[model samples]
Target: MNKKTVKDFFDNLAKDWDSFEQPDSAVIEKILDYADIQIGCSVLDIACGTGILFPYYLKRNPLSITAVDLSEKMCAQAEKKCTDKRIKIICADILDTHTVTDKAERCLVFNAFPHLGNAKDAVQALCRHLVPGGILTVAHSESRESINNRHKEKAFSVSEPLPSASDLADIFSEYLEIIHVFEDESVYIVSGRM
Candidate 1:
């Protein structure tokens, strides 16, 4: 799908996005656990609609967080969800590198991978913001196979298939080291260190 179509789809869903697509807390916990975020580290949550992962990140008591999303209404909702003064939310496209800053301790892409037009570009943008030795995680509330099947069923244009754990490792080979790949009952987590 083109950027406009993707933007409209999400914009239309912004109001009920969270309730309509509630993530499994178990899956969320597992992904965050694998992240192993440390205190005082700056983290970025990409495509962070409604900031579902914000609460989990807050538990780690990070020094700060930067959340970005393409939909303005979604960002508004996330702003309400995230009350911490340290959190800064940006309403912008993930593919726009100009909107992202550099060298975060961790960067997270959760439940929003397939929606991206260029997964490689998105990954590269995140990498640009990750400190040397920083971590990056990509997770979903369902298994890769399940997520793929659901997208097919919905007739959503998946420009690129979500990468497998091994695929991700290869993609980030130059900039990161694969740390772990976890596939639980309802989620898949791919963690890497920069």
Candidate 2:
């Protein structure tokens, strides 16, 4: 989807985004567990709609966090939810590498990868920002097959099919080391070290 479409989609849902349907708590917990965020590392939360994962990450006391989204309203809501001084919210597309380059110790693309349209570009962008040995975790609220089947049933055209855990590992293998890949309930966590 284009920026306007993404913006409009999230803007209209900003207020109720958090309460919208989501992965189970167990799945969320599993994803967070795989994050392995340290005490003082910089983090970039891409497409962090409504800041659902901010509080969880904040509890780990990160040195700093930059939460980015294509929707201004969603970013505003996240800013409000993330009261920590260490947090900075940006209303911008995550695919814009120049907008957020070499700034994070870790990057998270949670429940937002499929919507990216260009998953490879998104993965490369995250790889570029991450420090050497840094971590990049990409996850979805559902399995690849489940997501793909949903898209097919709905007759929606994705920019590219959702990649399986092995698919992601192979794509980023040149730049990152696979750390973990598993599904918890419907959520699938793909962790790698850059």
Candidate 3:
């Protein structure tokens, strides 16, 4: 699917997106644990649809957060959910390094990696946003198989099947140091550091 298809599909689902799709809170906690983020963390939340991770990130006492999405409606919803002075929302394709500056100590792509048009380029771009030792994570609350099945739904015209954890780790290794790769019935995560 093209960029327009992705935007339109997510836009149509933006308004009650949470009720239709909710990530488990445990997974959010797991991501935080893996990253070992502390106060003064600067974050870049890629594909931050509806700001689902906003509250969690806020609780970390981050210095700042840059939330980005391709769907305008999704960004609008996220804007409504997060009113923190540190959080900034932008609606733009992740592939296009839009007007936002890229300087974050932690870049997290929660449940939004597969939709990227090119995994390799996406990893490379995400790496550019990080500080020298910053972490980048592509994580999902559900198993890879479960997520693939969900993307098979009628609304998904621009989604790609998720690569196995090892494949993802290799992709990330091209630009960053592979830290951890975990995939099981409960969650999938590929984390690396620049």
What are the per-residue Cα lDDT tens digits for candidate 2 across 1-194? 57676678678888887786554766766787787777989998888888888778887888998888888998888878877888888888778756854468888888777767776677887788788888899888787787777766752543357788887877777678889877644778888898
**How are the candidates ranked when ordered by lDDT, highest leading?**
3, 1, 2
Which parts of model 1 have CA positions greater than 4 angstroms off?
none
What tens-digit string does per-residue lDDT give for candidate 3 at 86-126? 99998887677664666889888988888886788888877
User: Which model scores highest in TM-score?
Assistant: 3
lDDT string for model 1 (1-194, tens) is 57777767677788887788876776677788788776889988888988888888888899999998887878988989878998999888767756746468888888888887666676777787788889989888888888777777873763457778677767766567888776755787877898
TM for candidate 3 is 0.95
The local distance difference test score of model 2 is 0.78
Going through the candidates in order, what is the number of backbone clashes in each? Answer: 1, 0, 0
Which 10-residue span in candidate 2 carries the lowest summed lDDT? 151-160
RMSD of 3: 1.3
| Poorest 10 consecutive residues by lDDT, candidate 1 | 154-163
Stretches of candidate 3 exceeding 4 Å from the true structure: none
